[model samples]
Structures are given as C-alpha cells and as structure tokens.
Target: MDSATRVQESRVFPHPINVVWNHVRPADFKFWTSAVKETQVEGGLPGEVGSQRKVTFKDGTVQRYQIVELSDLAYFITYEMIESNPPIKSSAALHTIKLRKITHDNSTLVEWESDYSSSGNETASVVEDSRLKKKEALQDLAKALGSK
Candidate 1:
C-alpha cells in the first residue's frame, strides 16, 4: 500500500478576505490561466455547498467537482474526480481558502490548502506541482485585486 500526497500553501494579501474569496471562488477556473482552461458550473453558485462544476484543464481534460463545505467568508471546497484514467485512478482533492479581515481599510490574509492524497499514487508529484502553480496564482490574484 502507498500513501498519497498532501500539498498546502497560504499567502497574506493586503486586501480584505472577501475580496480574495470573490476572485478565487466566483471566477474559479479563471483564477489562474496556467492551472485551468474554463470552468463550467452545472449546479448551484460558488458559495453554496454541494454544488457541482466541471473544471476543464488547458489540455482539455475535465474534472467534475462538488462543493462539500462552505462558510460565510471562510470555506473549504472539494473536487473528487468522478471519472478516472491511467495516472489518476481516483482522487479526492480539496481546496480550503480562509479569509481574515484585518481592518476597515487595511490588509487580510488568505490561507489556501490543496490535498490530493486519495489519488493512491504516491510516486506521482501532481500535488507538489499544483502547490507550486498555486503560489504563482496567489501572486497573480494579489496583483489583479490590488489594481482594482
């Protein structure tokens, strides 16, 4: 038996948590160009739990994801691969984004986590890869929001 990989990362932004969550959740796939192609939501809205959405990769591979958990401004979202293939037989991926409001016109921190341990492929480095890519995304989000 092999253990799966768990990857997590967080960043502090100079903006409110709600602002960070807005870009990361509502425009999920559009959050980063390198990680996703376009997200096609089939169920409820972004903040609602139990909602289903299809995340299409730049390579055209699609992953059906469901919203398993949610909160007012702090929440966790999970994406389980309903369909499987060769490298990834099946996987349970979760992304948790927590927002902390610092002040009325000050900064906030955005904590992010992504776990892909249920994939069952210990040798695969997809989780690690995603972590690196996510760091860049955080920077992008910061830049994108700071200008607005």
Candidate 2:
C-alpha cells in the first residue's frame, strides 16, 4: 500500500503547552466536529498517554482515535474510521495528529496528517478535500481559543 494523501498545516499559539493542549486538543475538536454536528467523546486524561475517544458525525460517520504518543503534553494521536454512514471502504487508512510545543514563551504548533494505501483513490480525494476544511476549522479553532 502506498502512502496516503497528506495535507498539513501548523500554527503557533501564545499559550503554555498544557494550556495550549487544553485549549486546542478537545475544544478545537468541538469547533471542527460540532460545526458538522459531529461530537468527540471525552476519554483522555490530561498529560497521560494511550487515552482515546470516538467521534460521530451528524451523518452518523464514526472514527475511533487514541493518543499514541506523548511528551509532557506534546503528543500524537492516531485514528482510522471504524464506521461511517456511507460506509468507508478504506478502513485500513490511518490518520495521525502531532502536537509539538514552541519554546517561544508558552506556545504550541500542531500538525495533522493522514495516510493510507494508494488504492483508495476516491478516499484520497475526499481526504484532500476534507483537509482543506480541517485547516479552515483549525483557524476558527485558534481564534476561538484566543490564540490568534
């Protein structure tokens, strides 16, 4: 399987690592998923690793994700859709979100990525399209978090 389509954007926020994590981690999700009427469950503990949650969209699309790595608030989370309303066939694909802290006085930079086999051409296109929307949503999230 070839690498999945990738789209990434990062922003620096003027907030502490945990503060930034607290603001961006789940709250930002609310901005993204809630807008589309999707809500993510609260399952992860602050600064702990291996925590997880599920997100369900208004259309009944669902993805189960977990925090796979952590470094004192900086971390990475991964996910693959377990179910969807239209039934995503490329269930083998994976998405990873990396969060890194910026040293310049209480700030953090975030990176979001998705990967999967090349056979998922249609899924790749859709993922590409959604990445743009994600970027827009992230921007809104930053603003809402008072990071902008």
Candidate 3:
C-alpha cells in the first residue's frame, strides 16, 4: 500500500436531509450505483453500524465491507473494505458519505469520499479508475435522488 489516494465528490439535492441520507445509506447503496452488481447481507442490521455486506461489482470483483460508523446527527456514514476475493491492491480502504442540510430551500448537500492505498506500477491506473467510478457513482446518485 502507498499513501492513500483520496476521491471526493459533492452534489446538492433538492430534497430533505433525511431523504438523501436514507437514500445513500449502507443497505440502499445498490440503488444508486450501477458499479455494484449485487449486495448481500453478511451481518447485523442492514443499515446499522457493525453490519456487513458482501458486494459483487460489475467488474466481477467480490469484496466484503463493514459499516464502522453511522451518525444521523452529523449525517455521515463510514465503512471499511475488509476483504476481497481477488484481493484489492490497497492494504486498507475506507469510504465515507456525508450529508449537510441546506437551510434555504431544504435541499441537501451530499459528499461521497473514499481513501485507499495502492502500490507498484498499477497505482496510476487504479487511482484513475477509482476516480472515474466515483464520478459515475455520483452521476448515478443524482438520477436516483431524482435531481438529474
């Protein structure tokens, strides 16, 4: 693993904070991102912290993730990528999605961020791929949130 590669994107949704929050919660992630082929419950409550999900991506890579933190008050959820079958290049990866209220029109600002480490010659390709996927995911979210 090398120094973490960070990817972040923000969007504003013309919906209530809780609405955007619920839509992007751990369990409902599949609803917004086409990169995920399927997701299965692995442990605990589907959307609660400590819960786990086995996610199969469209690229055919399978990975397991654990919900490490969830805060409705602060409107953020953090999860760690715990395992991968083909093994991720990153020794460690953490993803966080945060939301903030826009007081004026009751819209919501959602920020999706991911930090991961990759090594060797594949780092540039991997980072660029991750950035593209994140951008696509955010674009997909805008459609799912009905803001597109």
The model with the greatest TM-score is 3
Candidate 1 residues 27-94, lDDT tens each?
A: 35576666677877778876567777777777666777677776663434445445432345325566
Candidate ranking (TM-score, best to worst): 3, 1, 2
> Lowest-lDDT window of 10 residues in candidate 2?
19-28
lDDT by residue (1-148, candidate 3, tens digit) is: 3676887878788999988877777654665467888888888988788999898988898889899998978999999999998986777788898999999999998887888887766666667776787778778878887777
Q: TM-score for every candidate vs. truth?
A: 0.76, 0.68, 0.89
What's the TM for model 3?
A: 0.89
Q: Report the lDDT tens digits of candidate 2 across residue range 23-100.
A: 445522665644456555546663344555566656566656565554443466565544455555454555666677
Q: Which candidate do you rate higher for TM-score, 2 or 3?
A: 3
Number of clashing pairs per prediction, in order:
0, 2, 0
Best by lDDT: 3
As for TM-score, the candidate ahead, 1 or 3, is: 3
Candidate 1 regions exceeding 4 Å error are 73-90, 103-105, 118-124
Off by over 4 Å in 3: none
Model 2 scores a TM of 0.68
**Least well predicted 10-residue stretch by lDDT in candidate 1:** 81-90
